[model samples]
Target chain A: MNAVEAVAKPAASKEKRRTFDVLEALIYLFAVMMLILIVYPIYFIVIASFSDPAAVAGGRMWVLPMGFTLDGYQELLKHSNIWIGYKNTILYTVIGTLISLAVNVSAAYALSRKDLAGRKAITLFFIFTMFFNGGLIPTFLTIRDFHLYDTFLVMVLPFSVAVFNIIVARTFFQSSIPGDLWEAAQLDGCGNLKYYVQIVLPLSKAVLSVLALWTAVGYWNSYFNALIYLKDQDLYPLQLILRNILITNQMQSSMGTGEAAVIAMRLANLMRYSVIIVSTLPIMCMYPFVQKYFNQGVMIGAVK
Target chain B: MSQSNAGMLHTLGRIRKNWGLYLLLLPAAVLLLLFAYIPMYGVLIAFKDYSPATGILESPWAGFNYFEKFFNSYQFDITIKNTLVISLYSIATFPIPIMLALMINQMRANRFKQVFQTVTYMPHFISTVVMVGLILILLSPGNGLLGNLFRLFGAEAPNLIGSAGMFSSLYVWTDVWQHAGWDSIIYIAALSAVDPSLYEAAKVDGASRWQRIRYIDMPMLLPTAITLLILRIGGLLGVGFEKVYLMQNNLNISSSEVIATYVYKIGLLSSQYSFSSAINLFNTVINFILLILVNQAAKKYSENSLW
Candidate 1:
């Protein structure tokens, strides 16, 4: 209550504030370091793609492209497999996303209905697969027996029923779409299919888009299915093509000794950087914009 | 008898009314039958001397013979050891994402927090193929980024990607880098749901920042973290096949030959269908048991569990 005591209290709290400031500073420092650690490698790849192979090898290029050239991209463009991969991946992603959304969203909605008969049994039927399944050999054999192997449909159809996506979408419908809405639709003489198509699908765009993006990304980046099922070169997706170029050491080659072989090898190394940038560019560009939608899916799941 | 007949008729009426719903579910049910259920039925081949020519059903019975072969094989110990080592190492780093989430929650500036999260989560969009490719390019001992940096110091860059000793570390840490930020999203959502009044109450009590995080934040994130940990433990042996298969070379095969990859190589590449199916059957059974055990333990110990 006294002026002297009030002044002393102010001085003591300021001292506490100073230590708090130090902790705040340390937190900021941690964030900045993590930012650098993640962004730097990606930045390096972008710059390295344009830089001359020799300069990149000599450590001359770090922050900026050193002795910039379009040689890597030029060489990559010349590879016909890369073009085939792009077309195949794009086709697969679009068709696969549509199939996934149709099957999962419909199933999700059907199960979301409290009045739907056998909802619990149907949901359990889907969820049980999540916990246990026959491993790869049996699955592969089944696909082969179904005659889906080595076909384009193999990429999109067999793996359509993603249980996790269905669960998330079902949660979204249960929580967001009211049971009264279905009752209202029924009173208006709308069938379950009509209500789902016209009303529910239109209203559930947020979750639908999120599921679509996830499925599309899965299809785009998929190689294991392609690797296992398809033996034809023409059927390969971008990831498989990238695997051959970047990991499998199957770079395009010509039989030439000494200097010519060395040039070919250097071009191959330089192409690795370009190939990564080319393949991942679309996802990276689209990610920042749609990042919130992906988070939306997580939040929906978390609430469940 | 009359009461039972009435109940059965009522159930039949419900099914007849909801026939459209069943129609909607038909595609998914059929897909599951083909891809999932049939594979399960096909797993019976593990107990048979599976000849692809004879098909899964017609394959002659050879109960436990292939299982015995796998148990007696030299690969049994090596594959199991490698799978466990990688999985346990990954689980050990599980706290990193929780810690990152906690740190991000402490930030005073909203814009900086968003930028930090976005940047960190960016790596996750990079596919497994590109990710392993980046690993090779950045660590290639001859002319990689590390190689170039080492040359500056007149020292040789060790072959990290191909090194048997570094296999697990490289796999786990790169996975951490790619996923920790994305994983933190769930915890961050959990943190955001914390009532601001709780923080105000803590501040009024003269609790320091660390004290607030300890008393308030830690308790809030505990249920979610425990649930995630249980799921992680349940799928302990289910290490992904993509990244490991991509990263494996002849040099590091000793440490990188996981159950998933081993099955792929054995069944598909070598066409030892019965042997590979048996190994796979064993792996799936163990994974399912672990999941059930962990879920049960969590249900008993805490309120949060996967039911």
Candidate 2:
């Protein structure tokens, strides 16, 4: 989309432009097909989320909500765990972003410095971990070892510094921060600490915001660690809770609809779509605001 | 001051100067060292009969034993074959994004185009579990919209989700539809960076829009495209696991059993930790070799590589 807007230079001679009429029509046809392919399923899911659970299962849903209802949302809301999940997700994303951004920026700044001791070694050390790591059992054991296995710390602490996020932050610091500023800071007896906190952090807002958003999203969407490490229901994030609901729905749907449990399970299955929407809605709302930065500021900031 | 004393003082002064920054970096450093690096050391379990009761220290030495077991496992050859082939299928479909970006680039900059682009990118963010659910709901043989549509056209509609032959193609194509637009963000950025002055010059020389794009946009995108291609190659084996896992049933597990799913079955479900670790270790080794080779190739070809 940005591609079309950015590269728009109106062509000469509408006739010449329309000369490849067959190909133009063909491309438009294919593009429309692709658009529908991408859009319709998700649109249907959203519609299904509001449809009467029984009607939807009877294969009656399409573009519009059938037997219109918000009962799925109501049912999902009644479960207090959903709110707990939302609270945990929000807390994790917000706090995790701050912790990660603080650590990543400073590490990136240190790694970006020309005169910093062992800068190359530090960068290499960080990058080395990206390509190889121990499998799940050992990592799970480590979480157990730290006694962080079921706590919220299991979700946030271990993944605080994503290597890619660090690299992007480091790249920005290297080019955007300007070596002359550092040199001048040193000359003015402004210590590295003051320069980083006072000057660098202030100047680094755009990329910092982008990294913060990425970290927040990572924390938001993460579930596998929660699945493995978390035993307690209270600690389950939105995704984990949603997965549980989905599995229960599957089991319910599989029992072939005669029993009272099956009827409730069918309601549970309808709630699956609603739960998905609920879990993703918070982050999606936050995304457009962060995404605007990615569209404009981050590109300029990214390239130094 | 004496030379050695001054050198020692310089080292200490440097450390003192950067102490605050070190303090800032300290938490992440400790986490990565403990969580990420320590696990690589724990890869030693592949060579031992590991027990959670005894821990890494007291685990009996097995020395090439798990790898031997994995190599001899009934599913070994098929898992490798399946993983590589599915990834190869993914690689083939990669250029669809380039084409989509180019097509979108050619469209007139209108509200319709913006809506179209937004629509395309939206699917990329739908959670994988939901995506598989959507696929299952939409493609069910007897009653799904598509299947029912096919029956109306006087044809027998097969159960797509149940078909092993359709699995990889369905996985790859669905991935393409979900991701192609979002992935085009960088290429779009690259396209925007193309010098419009070049297009103006081309127009003055009687060049067509197609010719101008062929000349300017394609060359501009090459660097970005090459960089992304290298990264994709580096990540060839590490396909996202959730969707495949969700999509699989007993009927289709034959083709759907890639290295990741196989590893999960072996480690998580079967508790063959050491053997699965060996398999994953092997996967990482292959990925490492590809990253280096592809990074070098990108550097050679386009002067754009991740390293």
Query: What is the lDDT, from 0 to 100, of the residue A102 in candidate 1?
Result: 97
Per-residue lDDT for B149-258 in model 2, tens only? 67667787788888888999889888887788877776676677777788778977988777876888888777767776777789888876777777787788888888
| A6 Cα displacement, candidate 1 (Å) | 20
Off by over 4 Å in 2: A1-28, A53-60, A257-266, A297-304, B1-13, B142-157, B299-302
The TM-score obtained by model 1 is 0.95
Model 1, range B1-307, lDDT digits (tens) per residue? 9999998899899889888888889999999988999899989999999897887678789999999999999999999999999999999999999999899998867899889988888888899999999998888777788888899899999988879999999999999989999899999989989999998788778888899899999999999999899889988999999999999988899999999999999999999998999999999899889989999999998898988
Q: Where in model 1 is the C-alpha error above 4 Å?
A: A1-20, A250-257
Per-residue alpha-carbon lDDT of model 2 for A155-217, expressed as tens digits? 777878787777787788877888999888889999778888899999988888888776776
Quote the RMSD, in angstroms, for model 1. 3.6
The residue-level lDDT of candidate 1 at B289 comes to 93
The DockQ-derived docking category for candidate 2 is acceptable
List DockQ, one per candidate, in order. Answer: 0.73, 0.42
- Which pairs clash in model 2? none
lDDT of each: 0.89, 0.76
